[model samples]
Target: MTSTMKPSYAIGVDVGATKIAAAWVELSTGQLGPVLRIPTRRDAPGEEIVADIISLALAIELPDNPDSALLLGVGVAVPELVDLHGTIRSQWNFPLPHLLDRLEAALSVPARAESDVRVAALAEARFGAGRDCDNFVYFSLGSGMSYTLCLNGKPYSGSHGFAIHFASSELAVPAQDRSALVAAIPEDYASGLGMVRLWQERGGFPLAQGIHTLEALAAQGNACAQNVIADAAGMGGRLIAQIVNMLDPEKIILGGGLGCSTGTYRTGLETEIRAHIWEQSCTNIPLVMAGLDENAGVIGAALAAAPPG
Candidate 1:
């Protein structure tokens, strides 16, 4: 019997600070199979991590028939600074140059790397919430915060390929002592870490609860949790509103564990965004949660490695 599977599939790897996830993407249908995740050996040498990534990609099951299935290439998404050629310049203090070279030699297939947020934006543009829009801004608010501006369905990586590093942009917030000035970045007030910091600052009960648990607690009417989340959401909204005002994107897609949740946080975020939007016409700009969720990064890597026909 003739196999119905496509002739080739792309492997996508998402390398995060805590874990590395990989999957095989069917080129013809854009379907992603089960993801294989391994705890990231962040402390290990960069070369070792690269080897792990390559091995994981090679181990993924392709189509049953050898003649019917081929490994197209590999795409990697890393939480680091990457150049246009997929070279990791620097991030997390790991030696990435050697790793990049080793990956290419070991894989024997075209390998492309990109910033994780950029890859996620690519995935959303092709298959998720941004599929119908040519221009949109993708915000990833997790342990870190980043945003990618997509124009004409392509991510705008500035001259240095660091256009999305909004976390470093300074923002003025009240000092902890309330007697002096404090300057903080968006990530300090808008990401998972920021939420936890806010909770701690506000002296929330059960201080051990993580961001997810805090969300649950907030849902249960915990005032401290609510305040922490609300503050973060509001700040996040202001940052997003700034992006909207500058780019005028048709939509703003929010991703990451905390950003995608539906409820008070999102409501508060949207409320602040609406309040800050300057243009009357921009008031209707859609602010939607990411549809692809966790798979977005890997799928995006695959899409970047092998552009759709």
Candidate 2:
């Protein structure tokens, strides 16, 4: 749609490994309207996923009278490395360019796509904790871990559109076998999976309760759970320190399931980060939780699809 004809209502879709969330966003207020979520059919073909996205977008309530409102476009955030041309480059292969094309054709409107975490960063920069900061690092710690650097309100995707792979960073060197160092990636010690693995390794009874159970146990002062969380905090702190030292960002915003922990867990994380921060000047850089929480991806996608002023 032309800039003058651009609608206030746009659709934002956040596609994750397990689920997809789609919402209608009001561009003028940076507010999200109705949100709908469905299980991501990973086993299905790319065409099916594209169809699902378009169907969800169409399900939202919009003014039937074109004079009152319009459907501007759709923006999608996918959990895979996406190039500038909106092509997926990672192993969880999806034909993103083709998907966007299909979405545009099906919806009769423009469509844009971006990396999921990058889109989250965009949301934060525009409407969340990073709103006041010009440069910051956004770390997402959930079932998996990823980060995006936002400079001057734009995500800094590297030359190949893959800048930092936080999960794959080696946090420690294996003293016994140098060759096995690759197995000690930071995510193994810092992510939700890391917490579960650490708990099991400590002889804690394997509960099928997942990260929530572990966090609950830790809150109740379970020694084993506390230890697991501590290790994760230490590792996460080190990672944050490295990012600060390398980028000197104005702020560090944490998001996702594990990153937004409260009470002792949050304290532990902040303490570890403070302990590892290098320069005294860099020590005061704010570490905050994502203001938009789960909505960051969808809100960001909508903003991305909005016509520039």
Candidate 3:
């Protein structure tokens, strides 16, 4: 559908490494309906992944008139890299590059897709943490690390939509390991998978359990888990501070699974942010939690399809 068509409602779906979440969005008001979540078939082929998204979209009850223009399209927020045309660019996780075409054909509605982090930032800009801020950074520490720079409530995808590839940026931060200084990219230690990998490398927890198990261990007074989490948070904070230093955004909004989780990680990140900020005046910039919770991605994805005027 053309932008002039102005669909009143859209389906927003967030595709993650672990789960797929979706919701119905009212385009005019930026309000989201109840969310539907299901585990992702992480190892499945692109076809299966697309099928899952189709299933989720179809699960939401359509209007009495299925052919009505009111429910106009599907908006997807995916973990993989997406191009300006809504084609998946990276095969790192799934090979469904023609996702938009397949989705549109299957659902008989227009569809749009973008980087999950970017869409989440869009959601926050329109309806969540960044709603009142004109300039801010939306950094997510999920299964992967990436960020979207929002200016005037619109996310800047850069000249080629490759701007926010923070995980592979080669920007290293220093940390102490066994009395020796070591450094690695933020993706190696700060992301959700990175934290789990760090735990496995340290040989403290069972291989099957991931970050949540580590959080549990930390809460139970396990020193190793606590240390690993603290170290990871430090790495994340240092990296985020670099963004703040460069952009000087009005605020930094944190989101994603690891980002929004309740634990010492948040406190640890805040502490490190205060410690590493180069400019004292910028140190007080509010490091606020994402206001939309898990629904941010879906709501934002929907908004992507049916942008608010």
Best by lDDT: 3
Models ranked on lDDT: 3, 1, 2
Tens digit of lDDT per residue, candidate 2, span 103-162? Answer: 888778898888888889988988899989889999987767889999988888898888
Off by over 4 Å in 2: 1-7, 41-51, 63-67, 93-98, 170-183, 201-209, 307-309
For candidate 3, write residues 96-157 as lDDT tens digits.
Answer: 64678878887788999888989989889988999898999998787888899999989999
Using TM-score as the yardstick, the better of models 1 and 2 is 1
Q: Kindly report which residue stretches of model 3 are placed more than 4 angstroms away from their true locations once superposed.
A: 1-7, 63-69, 171-183, 207-209
Worst 10 contiguous positions by lDDT, candidate 2: 88-97
Total clashes for model 3? 0
Residue-level lDDT of model 1, residues 1-309, one tens digit each, is: 885655668889998876789998876656897899998888888778777887887677765665677777888888888887777777653555566556668777788888999999988887888989889999988877888999877888999887777765786766878887787777777788778888877876554647778888889999888888888888888878988888888899998876787777878889999889999878988888888998999888888788667
The TM-score of candidate 2 is: 0.86
Model 1 weakest 10-residue run by lDDT: 92-101
| TM-score: model 1 vs. ground truth | 0.88
The alpha-carbon deviation from the true structure for residue 204 of candidate 2, after best TM-score superposition, in angstroms, is 4.1
Error of 2 at 175 (Å): 0.6
Per-model TM-score, in order, reads 0.88, 0.86, 0.90
- Each prediction's whole-model lDDT (CA): 0.82, 0.81, 0.83
lDDT of 1: 0.82
